[model samples]
Target chain A: MKAEAGCRACRGSCCGNPLVAELRGIPCNRRILLVGNPNVGKSVLFTRLTGVHAISSNYPGTTVGFSEGRLAFGNSCFHLIDVPGAYTLDPTNEAEDVARRIVDEGAEAVIVVLDSTALERNLYLALQVLERGLPVVVALNMVDEARHKGIAVDASALAEALGVPVVPTVAVTGQGINELVRALEERTRRAAPEAHSPAETTPPATLRSAEERWLVIGSVIQRVQRVTHRHHTWRDKLEDASVDRIWGGLIALAVILGSYSAIRLLGEGLIDHLLDPLANRLLLPLLEKLSAALGGEGLLHHILIGRLVDGAIDFEQSFGMLTTGLYVEFVMVLPYVTAFYTVLSFLEDFGYLPRLAVFFDALLHRLGLHGFAIIPTLLGLGCNVPGILATRVLESPRERFIAATLISVAVPCAGLQAMAVGVLGDLGGRYVLIPYAVLAVSWVILGRILHLVLPGYSPELIVEIPPYRLPSPSGLLLKLWFRIKGFLLEATPLVLGGVLLVNLLTMAGIVQAAARLTAPLFQGVLGLPPEAAGPLLLGILRKDVAVGMLVPLGLSPQQLVVAVVTLAMTFPCIATFIVLWRELGGRRLAASMGIMFFTAFAAGGLLHALFSLVGR
Target chain B: MGRQSSNFNPEQENLFRRTDSEEEALSNPAASEPPHPRQEAGGLRCPLRDVPNGRRVRVVSLPRGESGARLEALGIRPGKIVTKLSGMPFSGPVALELDGRQIAVGHGVSRAILVEEVPEP
Candidate 1:
């Protein structure tokens, strides 16, 4: 299952059969596995074919698990499995191996999705899949992209040469989905023939080598494909230079920063002016009355109503289930998450991410990582767990280590971002620049230092730059919807449960006791109050709780920045830490945590000292 | 086909299986050296040896991708010479200019891609 160098003899795992155990309970529906390289439209087609909800984002590594759903074509029902995108069957990493194993285990059939625009590269995988002698139907995706680029494909001719079905599809719009479903039906009706047929059960003496596979593909392509002359697109020449040039990098960086800022401003403005009023003015009052009727003082009441003090809902300490946690997460965090994902999906689907990666590759290389590492680093803006997990794409352990370290130490998650934008914008509109400056400086310094200190070789960049295509609106919307739903669910339960837990801890006087116990550390070392320790403790649970805790302390703009920055860099929320522990192992995780804790304190102390120096 | 290493994994063995009857056909030593159908460029000469690294040469031809026509249409087929602009220090990737277009190709892929040196103006 390992892909060693120059191992041409190794047929990829995608082109092999494993085994499948029949389920004794439910009727084993027609199981189809969607397998292909990363960034191909596998997830989109999976969603279209089976109507399954899989997160289909622009960057790689969004769909990390095998999601299952059903597709009903007429009276027939087929169960579909959407797997992680993989490059080669050689199983280079964990995710690739997961996909390999899924294919090895029997499925009714597999749809080898190929991007028509990158036909040759895409065909490499398709040829490998076909050699497996599995019941595979080639889903030639992005045909529209190809046509837009002046490449025309003869589907029937390709099908004839491949000795299997070839279905052209535009998964983003659900185009050719019915035809794909029909192709799958045809495959299932054939009952997945064994190798024992006239195809020779004993296996051939000389299997098709990689070169021969390409030759066969070339011949088939020669018969079925034609291209009319189109003027060379600007993207072809400008793409590499845009990110590769010095000035282009600066411009790209500015564009990225400006886009993020605009998204935040527009997102917050809409939510604050529109969504918040709906949630706060309409929803909260009704929820409070309902909790009142449910006997507003017991466990359920505390869980639902929170600590009601002096009348109106105290956005903070209203530590009730339905009132505080749900409201804060959904009303405050969800809208912004939705907006961020919408913008992210467009950037991803349009094929700009690779260029951005190319732009940042040189800078990242200084930190012992390549440009591909930008995927995880950007995701870290939203959350660290996925960011850490996304590091699986990094080829070297050293690059992953540095990437994980930098993200944990500097990158602020979405929740922290929301809090920063809200509080800092209100206090001193320009004060927001302070955190950005601090983070950027810290990132550069730390990244440079890590580049020197980290022990690993950074591989040279050779990434495939996909051509730009106009992103499908439905595709982008569906992607945004999927991620936003996941965020709400993941955050809502944790936030509400965290609120309840914090409430219980307060009622039992543990918050006071713990706050007192950590008083010296919070006050002397970090120069924040002991009460801030409570929020710091809750910050480990959910950043929202930590930011919520900050409200009571009533700190100045400088103090707020210090506390927020410290909290952000100190320790990620419990979930993220667990992922770090899993990815880096306990020892590395402990070391990372220890390094982060000290850095957070030292950094806060330094910032405080500098502010005082300027003040005098 | 190049000779594979004797150490084959079980998974790989399963993929490139050999049948008893077909083994006899493969036993002929001459069968091992498959025909190279690609038209070798130049007259009164064998395959060029020791094409120095970083030689500014245009690619006279290219080994196309899985879809050969698309690569051919990109002006990458025969007679479209390329220049070797740079290469990694330890015989790694070589950057080349072909038909006024530049691409970085790996050493293995580059070596197979036959190139005639571009004469200096």
Candidate 2:
């Protein structure tokens, strides 16, 4: 009954018991977990084994939580769970806490993924897991990289040292995966008899401390790993230069400028040459026929084709579920999303982000955050959902709150950025920079304020700066595909629904009344028309659609800047709001929203006053 | 592991010398005792922050708290050899190499990690 209850609760997704599987008419699965240190390519190994793509990166903490998938081999199936990377089982942070809990909860077998390049340090964790008495198959991952660095790890020696099977693997390619699976099969099969004899593997009454573990690990490493002198390659030079005090700063600046140019060039090219023509030549004609078939002016036509502006469909201004919704999501936003992720994924896979974090540490500390917060903030620029989720990598609750709040309020997602550019770019290139400038100022001011007000000290940066491996083209494309797929799935329906809701509200006369009620705030304080209220309201659901709504309002470029800035500072889109709540909980979420409202209004009013004084 | 007491520079030693009470306040009982014997024997000892870039040093002791434990977990424990690679100005993080891996430790954390220079082999 208890198993059935759990089965029902999870909808049979996580239930691994044979009886429960039989009752549900599904084959029983053996639970095998993959565990490793940060940046050890465990996620890649998980993907290889299960054929499920988990977002793998060159930096640490890419996976802040676990992901589950099923791997079928020979006859039996494996419910493979990729646990968050941990340096040790003795929990030092949240990720390690999750890892420790999962290991304690028990699995049919565990696969301890060891980085071949860092064998001595990696062995500390492997030994900890072995002391827990779990049946573990050691996956010596990244063997090729180790060899490239002139570090050789003897797999049989390592296995013999630990009394476990060690399979060397290069996860990026498919090398050694088949052998890994076979070794896993052999280990798990032998686990049956081993599980019955707890006395043999259970840790001693006097558990070893960290220093003691290191002592044992040192002996083990001496026998298994050999490091020889190697010539200094270009990669070594680049790595040194990247972290050099003067050179690191210069390189960081170059990276920022280069990334901006690349994103703009690629995004604009895609829109002009590809998506825009497709929408006009292919979709516009099809929509026109649908409009005419609907008798040119009805509820369906208004909702679907929207109002024809002077007998032509205006994709930007149309408040139709089909017209603006599809256009904004696919044409206006998707290209920018694609371009941004392409650049970000490359940086992630190239192992450059951690070095950037190092360069920014001193500056970030002034705002009560350490350098690692930049990862989440950078991610927020892509989309706030994962950005907020990545806050789990921060050590303290205070840091997570500050980081999440700052991300939601100051960091505009790619969708919002795309629409802002679309609306403001026509005014002038300079006009496009206004909202970004204001957002950057607000980010610093708000971060300082939060740091002053929040209790508890933020932990210092203790991140591993991974070696600069040339990013694999296939890995880059795969990661980009996963992010783009996520964007399409989460944004498509929301954009359509937001448009339909706007139409329905307009049809019911609610928009006019709401706009009227907010007239003084929009007209007097923010220097915008009363109709700006509608888009601001829509901004809560989808910021891109909200910015799109502003195009039809015909505000001046100054007012457009004011509106865009306010919209960005206000409530994040529904998806981000939900994630923030889940991450920050009710009390902190409320505090975060309160800050959002205050900042949005104050910034909007101040910008309005400044523009008015300047006579722009 | 050989001692090189003659390498001590009195001027540099004065830069890092701390009051006995301050050392006591920062020390954790659970960790090993302060490396006073090395200091008294005239070896050059200082916080990790004071170490010059590209110098190899052995960790002496860590501060008392989570950061120290975390540093240890990341292979910066006492008796380990680490090379100070780069340190940013304005109290930024110090990038160091341990066991052929690069690690960045923040300003406050670096200040609490005590290290002594290792004479070239």
Candidate 3:
């Protein structure tokens, strides 16, 4: 059945207008439909309601549709269907179309989940839904936050005016859950209506036009809402200034820089104190014993077990199962990955990001992008996979290419940065600043260049600034678990495999041959020893291993900075390459990869020549 | 009715509390009287723009500005009244709405408009 639809923004684009296609039948038993704006609380609510037995997520453009499950409310069982979120009934993106389809077809009832703080923005969509005339219940979620912000509403008055139940809820905490169930039960108890619904509840004579609806909304808000408080605290004022003014950008930058330093310091220290010991003292010993008992000598020993001629854990190279992958995955990489995600999540949960977007907006605009691009760029620091995927939030393909290129080139993934600090930190604590400076300058300069070359208008810097609060510990920790688990599953395997592959390539004499061929450029242009070629080539696998190998060569601080920059700008690691290929498409991917190779060499050569001229 | 995409993750309780219905539904009953859904308040209501200078009257409905398309979709249509929820000390965003939905407009956007508070029912 066609649902009531009236969104002022869309102006009858949803159910308020005529349908372009024929109405379809609802052939299923459980008639549940999901609703909300994109990136609000829909998916989380869907997951919580449906459990783990459904198609929770899917790749974009895929033909696979909504997921369904059964939910029991009181004495009744209903089918719960999770559709995509849309701004209004108006479908702009692929996800919106999915939501549109569900509503156009029949559903028993629709629950409109509105974000509490951004109520005005959300209500635009709600109005469209209410116009459809389906059984409607307003799930007034996030009530606690509204009160905290000194905003109050009158639900009873709202229900009375709208002619539907209004349920206040904190879905995450499951507050008002029983009431929601009762409301749903009340909605379902009514006899099934005729298959299709009328376009409007009343004839055109009595129907309210767009102007009348706003007038009605205004009057209802006036009657129901009471302002109990008049003043905001100082902290809220500071945030308003930071997000609203030109100076806001600078403040955001300072906050981001402070966050980065804090994360690095805390993450590195925690790994050193707790995780490193567990890996070294416990996991490594167990793995070594397991491998030995499996096979200590012979050919099976050669590939899998490795030879243990002496008592020194003797292995030809670190690539054997016992030697490389196991160590890299469990020991060298896991501690740092765990630490990185925990810190990253804390900042995200604290709501410091959108403010940073304000700061980055101008700079990004210069680079033919907008401030929101910073989100993916920041994510790139952890791993390029999600970073590339997140570029979907950007508007155009050209922006995506530039963002991907900049991220792959200038942004240092956790593994690379950790390795850089680990390798050169002991030589001089001050050396850490060099990579940061180089990256900062390169990103700025490269972004400027890309802006001049790329085509498209950078989107505006409009962002929602969530009020600051102490993050929920349980929620934050759960978020951390998801992030860290993704790292362990995706990055750890690559690091392990990359380390072993490099080790095997070196052992097989291929790396030596490659290094020999690049010896002249390595020595004459980059001013590094020819042996550095092997690790630089191997850097694509996992950056830390490349840096670890560099320890044996003993490069000076100046040389270290150049080497690190070159390594970072060179080909992205195997994982990132996969993402780049997916995001950039075949042609652009190849082009960017080619540019990266040349840039790495050219920049390193230029820096080397300059440094030598200055008597370094 | 058109369905709202339940896409938001309200993992934190506060995020869900700020919506119009939730804010009104969850208010402390002791602070004021229990809600009367359909009454038109005729008592003095504070106009946010007028503040101390303006006369108090019950909110009747939202005034539709030139951007006719968007405000309508926002559930900000007529017949419902609004009260000035809060004008923060620093004069940033002001929260107000029609029906149960809320809107927090920046000071610049809010100042251009006028509001008349309706008396309590």
Candidate 3 at A381: error in angstroms? 1.6
* CA lDDT, every model vs. true structure: 0.65, 0.83, 0.59
In candidate 1, the residue pairs with backbone N, CA or C atoms under 3 Å apart (3 or more residues apart, or in different chains) clash, namely A18-A104, A303-A321, A306-A319, A306-A320, B57-B82, B57-B83, B58-B81, B58-B82, B59-B81, B59-B82
DockQ of each: 0.05, 0.31, 0.04
Candidate 1's C-alpha runs over 4 A off are A1-31, A59-64, A71-79, A92-94, A191-207, A233-247, A283-327, A449-451, B1-121
TM-score of chain A of each: 0.85, 0.94, 0.79
Question: What C-alpha RMSD does candidate 1 show over the true interface residues after superposing them?
Answer: 12.3
Q: Identify the leading candidate in terms of TM-score.
A: 2
Please give the range of 10 consecutive residues that has the lowest summed lDDT in model 2 chain A.
Answer: A19-28
- Per-residue accuracy of model 3 over A37-72 as CA lDDT, tens digit each: 644555445545645222111111111245554455
Highest lDDT: give the candidate number.
2
lDDT of 2 by residue, A157-193 (tens): 8777787788998988978888888887787666352
Worst 10 residues of 2 chain B by lDDT: B1-10
Q: Least lDDT summed over 10 consecutive residues: which range in candidate 1 chain A?
A: A1-10
C-alpha lDDT of residue A489 in model 1: 71
| Error at A98, model 2, angstroms | 0.4
Off by over 4 Å in 3: A1-33, A38-40, A51-86, A91-109, A132-135, A185-216, A244-254, A283-332, A513-541, A549-560, B1-121
